[model samples]
Target: MIAIQNLTKQFGATTAVKNLSLAVNPGETFGLIGPDGAGKTTTLRVIATAMRPTTGQVTVAGIDVTHDPEAVKKTIGYMPQRFALYPDLSVLENLNFFADVFGSPRAQRTELIARLLGFARLGEFQTRLARNLSGGMQKKLALAATLMHRPRLLLLDEPTTGVDPVSRREFWDLLTQVHLDGVTIVISTPYLDEAERCQRVGLMYRGELIACDDPRQLRANLGAVVFEAHSTRALQARKLIEHRAGVRVASAHGDQLRLLLDCAERAAEIQTFFHANAISVDDWRQVQPRLEDAFVLMIAQEKQP
Candidate 1:
């Protein structure tokens, strides 16, 4: 449903997206995963036809974005990072307004709005003003507005960034439903956990798409073993493990330290190092690598060259 080739977006001397190429199949949920300034948003904007690419081509639902952006917009729904709803408008009013903007037939507006309200779980708050809704509800409203025209593809840029954990789950549930119903979605997110939910993910770094695959495949290709270390002095444990031989990466994850070792044999050395450093090792075990681990490893390797 989406194709990008040799895409590059430049602002002044800075290139936000460089030679990035990707393709999304119909009825698939594809995620663009990366950190800030990684060009995920710039790439999405070009696909949404909101921003023109500096050099290369983008096609949405088989329509060239640069050649016919209007037609491309008609086939895709774009929800930006920030809330774009009118604060004073009631939930129903906002839906109606967007429906009108999309030229939804008067005959279909009421039924479409009703369905969207229920789908987003905002039916009870239809009479409430947009300003009165929670952050998550506001995002849902924005999504509903974006979907008013029933676009075949969704271009979402960090739709759940600041939402609470429960709301984030709810939002993804909604997205899963939409995907199941056959709306191809291309979303950008900073959350590795969220990326894991995608059918496929493209990892971006320094404006380039470095790795693209299913989450499990990416983790398996990490070429390292992951060990979870628990200690009361987690910070101290991280410090001791980071400089050890055969330890490729050590990062603090919540109250535990996640160690990426060059080989499985390094696990014993890591344990001994902690013992020698007087950093209490409450527990240590080899675990399956996560998407975050794979991403960090990809970034570290990229920096080496």
Candidate 2:
């Protein structure tokens, strides 16, 4: 489990994290979802005991991070955003190196290496140099290295960034298996779809924790009616609706335009507005809000004050 209270991290005059308080239960998969420079990485580093906070407190598995960082490190695994693998080292070599760093007993290293290689599906590529492997394989290798000591808590910062879609799904499947086995995970991700996979999510923005809740509850609390409008003139439709009364959000999504209205009764009026503007709509219908929708709304509201 991880606990943080009023945690603030500052670098010189720039405040990275501002009064953030959070808790993660045992065996739970918690996500820190945010955009670039939103303080997700800063908060993760503080919890991992890699960086000292300007104020507040952080604890991992009953050990205070600032007071006893060495003790906290033993109970947690921290994987940074960048690839940490040595290109010249083979997959097996990298694993062996990390095992040695963790001080795995010689008697257990063989079995542990075998199990981790098998778990990460790197058995076939054990002899392949890391530089020769694909991006996804390298990430898997880094994860295997992190698991060499079998820490109780895992801290991953944007682990899936730049990975192919298929590989991202495979990586999440592995994390799900790990979570099922009772290891607590705190992962920071920019992908809303990935955030939905977490048991609970903390939405961070502008160095502050704006919203935190289960994905479903967060979407439900949007308190708006969302509609997807498909049209050849999607851009024009967005412009027409962006400044309309009761319209909370109007943005183009691919070939379609999404609208979030403050009142469900305004749906008819939206249709009327399109007709009045001489815009031909291919289709339009109210739909359930998504995590991205809720996040955008939250950010917009936060900027109001």
Candidate 3:
């Protein structure tokens, strides 16, 4: 459904995306994940025909983004990170406006808007002004507006960033239905759990894609063992062993320290190190590698001199 080759985008001397190449299959949910400045948003903008590639090629649904951006825009729906709706407009008005902008058939506008209102759970809020809606509701409204045209490909840039957990789940539930209907989706997200939901994930760092694979396969192929060390002094424990031999990466999550080690045997060595440092290890055990672990490991490797 989407193809990019040797994609590079620059602003002044700073390259936002560098020599990136990737492909997304029709009907698949492809996730782009990384830290800020990783070029996730830039890539999405280029694919949506919102920005031209400095040097390279991007195609959406067989239409070249550079040569035929207008045609390419017809095949995709782009929901940016920020809410792009007019605050003064009511939910219904915003939907209708976007429908008009996209040139939705006048004959089908009423039915299309009605179905979308119900689909987005905004039927009851149709009369509510967009500025009055909660963060989650606003995101849903934006998504509804974007889908007014019935685009085949969905490009969402962190659609659920500030949304509450329940709302995030609700949004994903809606996306699940869209995926079931075979609409190709490419989303960029900071949440690893969200990435795990995708059919495949691409890890971007320093403006380049470092890894791409199914979530399960990415975790399985991390080439490391993860161990969680629970301690009241989690941060201290992390600092002590983060750069130690055999310990690849260490991050503190609340009262526990997530340790990525080169081998299972390193677990005993980590425990020994903790003991010697007087860092109480209340609980320690091996844990399954998660998508986040794989991402951290890959980015860490990329930072190696």
Expressed as tens digits, the lDDT of each residue in 54-156 for candidate 1 is 9999898889999999999999999989858989999999998898889999997889999999999999999999999999999999988998898899999
Q: lDDT for each of the candidates?
A: 0.91, 0.90, 0.92
Over 4 Å off in model 3, which ranges? none
Clash pairs detected, candidate 2: none
Q: In model 1, which range of ten residues has the least summed lDDT?
A: 236-245
Ranking by TM-score: 2, 3, 1
Count backbone overlaps in model 3: 0
TM-score of 3: 0.97
- Give the range where candidate 3 is weakest over 10 consecutive residues by summed lDDT: 269-278
Ranking 1 against 2 by TM-score, winner = 2
Badly placed stretches (over 4 Å) of model 2 are none
User: What is the clash tally of candidate 1?
Assistant: 0
